[model samples]
Target: MPATAIDIGTYAVKVISADPGKQPNIIRTVETLNPHGIAMPIDDLQIEQVGELVNNIVFDNKIPHADIRLSLPESIVSSKVISIPPLTDAELASAINWQAEQHIPIPKEDLSLQYKVLYRPEKSKQEQMRVLLIGTRKSLVDRFINMFIAMGIEPTLLETHVLSLLRSLDIGADEPPTMVLNIGATNMDVVVIFKGEIQFVFTHSGAGALLTKTLQQTLGLDLQQAEQYKRTYGLDPNQFEGRVRNALIPVINTLTNEIQKAQRYFASQFPQNTLSRIVITGGTSQLPGLVEYLSESLGTEILFSAPFASATGEIPQENQQTYSVCLGLLMRELA
Candidate 1:
């Protein structure tokens, strides 16, 4: 079977279709500006706009529509991890709503809740199962469904960008604990993966837009020039005589501080392990000197994401980071 995935971001929307395998053949890829400003938890009024956008993208590129998976931004969803005594499949199906009520702030009636059994203690009677609970407004889900219908497309799955980001990486079991950072236009997610399994996610606000604004303010450059300088110089000390790096440091410190706290807490929880490397992705993360700066700040190895390395296809160099989530979604069926 082939897989087609769509990733909608604040500034753009990307679609990809590929054959199913470890290194599947990439059929086609399309990316377009989201000129209509459609949001994640879209309103009823915006459904038509989203539909129009999807209609144009799919039609513009001869994308094979199979297992159409869509990724929703994490900001519109509420998630929590809870522990409960292990239960049978039937028991879990019946108990999930109740568990959701205790962990999620949304009203049960208005929420569309989903859960995944993250861990189960096989031999220990005293240990409880850990479940990942994800919740979002029912209205939001309905709107996305309606939008797809209007475009004559039946979506096979609705998911978050975090899972897709994880899917894009090729984490090794023997590798040291690693952090995956996704810094997008409006938000950021720092996920810690230990021994090829996701341990937790640390989300933060103020990402690329914030950094660009900081450059604009301190450098007295227009928004366009500021963004250009941000990409060209980033936090690299040697570039631009270190001015751009200096201006951006204070702003980046806020995120580095939060990530460092998460690192400390994870260490406390798993005393034997350390977060050694960070896999940086997303358009903002591709900044000229970000990987080096983050590695220095956290005292960890940093690697930029190369999502298509294992996939048999050629993609634009700049689009590599931007398309990570969609590539991961495609992997759900392909790999």
Candidate 2:
């Protein structure tokens, strides 16, 4: 049975259901924006509203009430790649718990931990396995699970957005090391993948919302008008005699600086791997000239995310980037 994949973002909720077999036709894609002035689901009222919206989508679309695969914002999850001495399955379980204590700041009792061995030497006698550790606050997990349960849906899998994005893109082992920048409304998620494995994941507060705020404060436009201007003249100095561009340049510079820092850090850790390309996603990534600007600033080939490359669907061109996370979650469920 096909599973429903939902990405509940700060500004919008995107849901996609697809038949994973036979070219993966997308059954439906539902996107609903939050009400004015409500940025994220920070309170019970907003959460309840989101649940209702999802329930309506399921009912209207006749979506099966089965196990749903969900993707959480990167802000709620902490992921790291660590090395450990190769051990048997039983020993690995114990070792991961011990290692989690040192790496995860939350108390073990308050966190839900998951791990996967990304690489293990086949013939080396003194090789260590690289393991990916994901830790989430148990309460947050439970809340989302319960929310789904309330709507008669089972939460089968919950993954961070970065992993889902990587899976959706289906970066191949033959491809060079690549970086993905997901600029959401409230935060930005940066991920580095090499040889089909995730090397780094980081989330920060500088993203679309910052740019919106800057425009609103500088131009005295309302939230809606500021957002319109952002999409219309983002980083394009030719617009409004460069007034909008000027308002946005500071934030863009800061974002690029952070990306450079991340690139440098990754290079320091893995000198053998050179980043070949950068893929930008999220709703904000659609801003005019963002691709060209980022390419010029980072001095790397920059591309927009196209998550539907392997899936045959009638998705709108404007919505492809916004639905990258949702499509990735569907891909994960199908896999």
Candidate 3:
């Protein structure tokens, strides 16, 4: 049976069903907005609402209660890269568990941990392997798992949004260093990838919602009007005599400043590897002139995420960006 991949975000819940293959057939896609707007996962009411949304989508689409893959929001997952001496699988597991105590701030008993070996030296004297460690509170994971269980959906895999984003891009092992800027409704995730491995992931509060709020406050317009203006004239100095652009400049600058800092830090760490290009994804990435603005400001080539290039589908263009995480979760299952 084909698996269902679900991406639960602050503003919306996206679900996609696809068969396993080189080019999975996107059987169905469903999205539903959260009526309560943005709420932290700690809120039981928000969780209940999300569960209802998922239940409605599954029922409306007549989707079977099959194995489901979920994307954990970046805001709740703590990720880090740790270096340790090469060891046997058994030894590595023990060592990682011990190391987790030091790296993860939460008590080890309260957090569920997972790690992936990212890089290992072929013929080096260092004798160490770089591993990516991810830790999340058990309560958080259990809440989602229990919710799905109650709905008769089996939760098989749960991964960070950054990792799922990486899989969606189909990046090659030999590809150069690239940065992925995922601008969503409530938050922005900045991910740095090199040689098909994630080097860094950062999340910020500056995103589409912030831009809309800025516009609403500055122009004294309603939420809907502000959103329309942002999408229609975003960052284009020539539009609305630059009023919209001027209003959004402060928020844009805050996001860009963080991006620039991340780039500098990455450059410092990897002096030999220059960022080859940047790929922008998520809902906010489609704002008018965003590509041009980021490309010029970061001084790097900019591209948009195109997961559908390999998959055969008839999804709408406007929904493509929002489905990236969902598609990526399916890709992970296929792999």
Least accurate stretch of 10 residues (summed lDDT) in model 2? 34-43
Which parts of model 1 are misplaced by more than 4 Å? 36-38
TM-score of each: 0.91, 0.93, 0.94
**How far off is residue 75 in model 3, in Å?**
0.4
State the lDDT of candidate 3 residue by residue for 60-126, as single tens digits.
8887557688888888888888878777778888788888988877788789998988987776566
Clashes of 2: 0
* Candidate models: Cα lDDT each: 0.81, 0.82, 0.82
Q: Model 2 off-target regions past 4 Å?
A: 21-23, 36-43, 333-335
Query: Count of backbone clashes for each model?
Result: 0, 0, 0
Please give the distance, in angstroms, between residue 307's alpha carbon in candidate 2 and its true position after superposition: 0.4
Rank order (by TM-score, best first) = 3, 2, 1
Q: Against the true structure, candidate 2 has what lDDT? A: 0.82
- Top lDDT model: 3
The superposed Cα distance between candidate 1 and the true structure at residue 8, in angstroms, equals 0.6
RMSD (CA, Å), each prediction:
2.3, 2.1, 1.9
| Higher-ranked by lDDT: 1 or 2 | 2
Error of 1 at 134 (Å): 1.4
lDDT of 2 at 128: 80
> Model 2 Cα displacement at 258 (Å)?
1.4
Ranking of all candidate structures by their lDDT, best first: 3, 2, 1
